[model samples]
Target: MKIRCVIIDDEPFARKLLLDYCSRVPQLSVLGDFSNGLDALSFLNHNQADLIFLDIKMPGISGIDLLKTLGNRPKVIFTTAFAEYAIDGFELDAIDYLLKPFDFPRFLKAVNKAFTSFPIEKPAISLNNSPQEDFLFVKDGRDLVKVKLNDILYIKGQKDYVMFITKNRKIMSLMNMRDLEQDLIQKAFVRIHQSYIINTQHIELVASDKVRLNNEYLPVSQTYRLTFREFLEKHK
Candidate 1:
């Protein structure tokens, strides 16, 4: 369920930065990049893309103009230095507007907004584990600790980092929630809220608004409640 995306920016450095950010999220697949709107318009016309990270101002054609020319437009997140174009971008129903020099957290916020508008399909459940591939490394102080997927009781996002809570240890990693969600969703991890991802294997009780895991009640936020309930219904 990767979001196939294209980057359209005149600046090489901006394109590179967006590409790097997109790479970190396992759900995003970069299809192409272009330095000008015309070239991007051509590529988009011939191919299908789910999302676009577009610069508002570019030579030959502005980002707004390029979007207008397209008959079938994908979801767009406008990235530019200009503040004046923000109103216009939103008028056209852009997913988000990222000011130039935005950091990873800001970029991730915009991406999360896009997900709300265009939610990806639920991942296939895979709770079974293999010795070699069922584990992932998380940074804890100076150490990269190996935490088995099945051992993770739940994960909590705090600011720019997420805490991996297992039975014996709580490992903290500098990772965003969106990237973590995509990484663990296939392994029977379900996002109950913007701040919580719970391992389905550890569910003790499911209430109307909260799920009990390891004697801890975690909220199932409105944004994620529908999908989480669907997961439960399918498994039941």
Candidate 2:
């Protein structure tokens, strides 16, 4: 089943990054996004989102607080820059915790880990075993690396080549996000900047200007921020 998802981050760049990743995956449809918890809560009462790509800290309501307020809980992946919150987030039964400034491969690992329900690892999300469009082959040196779609965090564009960042590592190749996304297992990837594609699950902070990935940041051009907000709402 396609995971209907929502994004909640105050950062504009962060929102755009997630949107770009979602565009690639066919199954991970974003339902909405929100800058604050209250706004997101209002929408959730009327709509249902399957997966939540949530940020831990915000101005009004932190992500953890919002999650606590809700009874109709969806699968949650917490994003944060501070390692101190890791324990707290996991204590809330978060599916996974992603540190900021994470590359696609690192982000992928968290998602893949989150895909497997903890304690039992039941209700697993596996691209290979699924009956739908499942796998993708990436060019790695002289060999073709077959990557399960769910295992990718984000695809980054660098000049003429693209970097396929996976859960385990990165593989650079002569490819484009446009073409690679065509076969992406889910639409959870978003292009927040011309050079960066981000996995929504790993976002640490969101602002009107740039998305904070831990200490590092990415700029959100005016051209992309507005639509990115709309994208967040859909997933929410």
Candidate 3:
């Protein structure tokens, strides 16, 4: 799945540069761009992102202060003109620190490190001979919850966890979307985008660029559009 990212830098040129750089990376998606930490923090309260490109020296709230406000923080990479904040950034367990005037190659190196550190390990499962298993158990915190495949409407991949969106509730599990896709493909689940896997049976509409699953409008990226079209044709 592409990493959803937000860029927060006080300088307009800096934000634009990061946005342009992110566009060049296939695995990175710019979800929001902000000139200050307050706006970025507000956006995070309602939306989810996988990674953040932050500036350490903002006027009101520093990048370090913003990190402190987050409860379930995403991976962060500090971008600043000063080198002194590198130690503090690392102390907060940031993925990487980039000094201002950094080149594309340097930005890419930091991103690569973030991707490498993200956990996408496959969970252990003993499947039956049947290809269509009705249910499976996933680890959620300290509990092993049994989830019925039929109950799931779609699966949204976060950085390290996949959220199982069922008819009545959402279950968060520590699992990789790619591994889950392999296991569930035989049961009629189709990956319409890097970040979304939909139960074909629940797909309400298929547009040229998006799929409608009930009330949710999930994007169908160019990478998977042709395959999704074929799936629709066969099932229709």
Candidate 4:
């Protein structure tokens, strides 16, 4: 299935560039393009899209602000001329951050990363069925690496990619934190912060504002503190 997409940018050239690039990828289909966040938000209220190409800087409502208003967010790729917004975009769980004046090859790479995460169909979730089935295959660069869920200590989100922290090795993949969270939610993994998700089995200690795993300390943000506490109570 082609991924339905929309473009929101204040610059006409940027919008046109993305529209042209979307056409070159057979996996992508353009649903609409708007010059402002409000129009795009209005359209998205009634429409369903798989992806959004958003600009960070805009009049009235910025792309970051628009993301806050979304109830069910589509995969977002932030395009901007400024590099300063990269960290902010990643914090918002964007699929990819594209700097301005990017070539087709770079654009294609970003779209491919998104496609890798948001496939037409997801694999069946049978990881909890048996000990032997409790593993997942993640793309690490050009290779797919098999990681046992039991061996995972924690998962860390670094910008657009996530690192699978295991007992013996750390595997980094081109994936968003949100997408990885969905895949591992049923496997006893919980998000402790915007940048950290830990395997409850490996938790060494729980503190007021952070969690300890082995020798590392991971913060438990207010956003997830209550949920984490409830989880602790239930498990106890």
For each candidate in turn, the TM-score is 0.64, 0.51, 0.51, 0.52
Off by over 4 Å in 3: 120-236
Residue-wise lDDT of candidate 1 within 1-236, one digit each (tens)?
A: 78899999999999999999887665679999999999999999999999999999899999999999999999999999999999999999999999999997678768767766765632111222575669776645434577889899999999967898998988876666887788777778999998999999999999989999989999999999999999888877
Number of the top TM-score candidate:
1
Q: How many clashing pairs in candidate 3?
A: 0
Q: Report each candidate's C-alpha RMSD, comma-separated, in the order given.
A: 6.6, 19.5, 15.3, 9.9
Q: Which of the two candidates, 1 or 2, achieves a greater TM-score against the reference? A: 1
Rank by TM-score, descending?
1, 4, 3, 2
| Clash counts for the predictions, in order | 0, 30, 0, 0
Instruction: For residues 1-236, write the lDDT of model 2, one tens digit per residue.
Output: 66678988888877777676555444467899888888998888789887788888888888988999888888888877778899888898888887775555544445445544433211112224465745666645434577765566566788656886666888886555554443341465566767666666556788997776435577777766876566566766
Better structure of 1 and 3 per TM-score: 1
Writing each residue's lDDT as its tens digit, candidate 4 over 169-230 gives 99986566776787777778888899999999999889999988988999999999998888
lDDT of 3 at 149: 76
Candidate ranking (lDDT, best to worst):
1, 4, 3, 2
* Stretches of model 4 off by over 4 angstroms after superposition: 1-109, 112-131
CA RMSD (A), model 2:
19.5
lDDT, model 2: 0.68
Query: What are the clashing pairs of model 4?
Result: none
Better of 3 and 4 by lDDT: 4
Candidate 4: C-alpha RMSD to true structure equals 9.9
Better of 2 and 4 by lDDT: 4
